[model samples]
Target: MREDAVKEGDKAPDFELERQDGGLFRLYELLKEKNVVLYFYPKDNTPGCTKQACEFRDQYEAFARLGAEVVGISSDTLESHQKFEAVHHLPFTLLSDKGGRVRSLYGVPRKLLLLPGRVTYIIDQTGTVRYVFDSMNKPLEHVSTALEVLKTISHERNTQNV
Candidate 1:
């Protein structure tokens, strides 16, 4: 397994992936104005992935209140992502890593029988990764954890810059 594919204080690698909404999503461009939660999952409409996506959807407002945007990336196509979003009412961008290039760049390991493991990267507004949560627990919990980490990082940054 590739360890520490990304770390705190390191500039996040940029990418332009296709979004479910039929547009391009440039990582750096999106991070230009706000923090982002980039999650990589295995497939669309899977049990675990679906649960996690819905969790993010339910807490979409909370993430926004903290000036953070959640974006999910997977090896699935944009069409699959679109269907998943429409079915779940997900209020976030789902990026298509059709070639798995982004996944490889992020060093997300393949799971049993060639599946993408669950990995979440919490990046700050300046494009530095602040936290990474790699877990397959209830997807909702990951959103909460990301929010908590963002709040903590934001608070610390403000205090230091004061």
Candidate 2:
């Protein structure tokens, strides 16, 4: 693991990438509205990546209820992401990180030093990473873990207000 790898409580590295819709997406800009569940996957249309994306899609409403927005990033082309979103009916934004720069910025370690990493980062509205799940085999767990973390954060914030 890279020593500079983003960890919980660290500020998330900012990035800009093309959305599936061909529009630009800036990490800090999205952070202004709600918390972000930023996930980095390996590829588009692959079995594991598809399962992970669908899992996020299925739990998307729950994330929204918690005032969180889910975003997926991979080093795929914009056209590929568009097709993937259309085919899977993914409800959240999918960003195309063509060169994996953002992936490297997050210090997402490649699986076995070969394939791109499968990792998820739950970033709070304040731009701090609240949680990170790194796993290549258990894609579906990413959704459940992120949702749980977001719920915990929400609960903590509500309790502090009382």
Candidate 3:
């Protein structure tokens, strides 16, 4: 892991970017309401990226039930993201990071030093990163790993309230 990479328990670096719908998405604004399943992918229409987005869409309800929102970030343009969401029937926010600025903030490593790495960060409502999973070759695992971590965060929160 990169020494500068944001790790578990670190405060999530806040960022704002254009969403697919052409509206600004501010991370801290959303974190005020629910936990976030924030994923960084390389591209919009690529095979691995598509599979990862669809998996998140399929399990979206589970994430919401745990008081979380799914958000995907990539260097893809808003127009591309709009098309990608329409094609995949994605039911979450897609943020466009034109220059990989947010990706850099998270220290998301690149695959083979060429393609952007696939990574997932599970952030709680308070804006603290609870977990992070990095696996460029296992796109599907990103969704599963996020679900598991969200479940654990939910369980821990419930226990704390008791």
TM-score, structure 2 vs. true: 0.97
User: Which residue pairs in candidate 1 collide?
Assistant: none
Q: Model 1: runs farther than 4 Å from truth?
A: 160-162
Residue-by-residue lDDT tens digits, candidate 3, 45-147: 9999999999999999999999999999999888999999999999999999888899999999998889999989999988999999999899999999998
- How many angstroms is residue 9 displaced in model 1 relative to the true structure, after the best TM-score fit? 2.7
TM-score of 3: 0.98
lDDT (Cα, tens digit) per residue for candidate 1, span 45-76 = 98889989988998899889888999999988
**Candidate 2 residue 123 C-alpha distance from true site, Å:** 0.4
**In model 2, what lDDT does residue 122 have?**
97
**Candidate 1, TM-score vs. the true structure?**
0.92
Clashing pairs in 3: none
* Location of the lowest summed lDDT over 10 successive residues in candidate 2: 15-24
lDDT of 2 by residue, 1-162 (tens): 568899999999998888888788999999999999999999999999999999999988999999999999998998999899999999999998878899989999988788999999999989999999999999999999999999999999999999
Full-model lDDT, candidate 3? 0.93
CA lDDT, every prediction?
Answer: 0.86, 0.93, 0.93
Q: lDDT, candidate 1, residue 11?
A: 86
Query: Could you tell me every candidate's TM-score relative to the true structure?
Result: 0.92, 0.97, 0.98
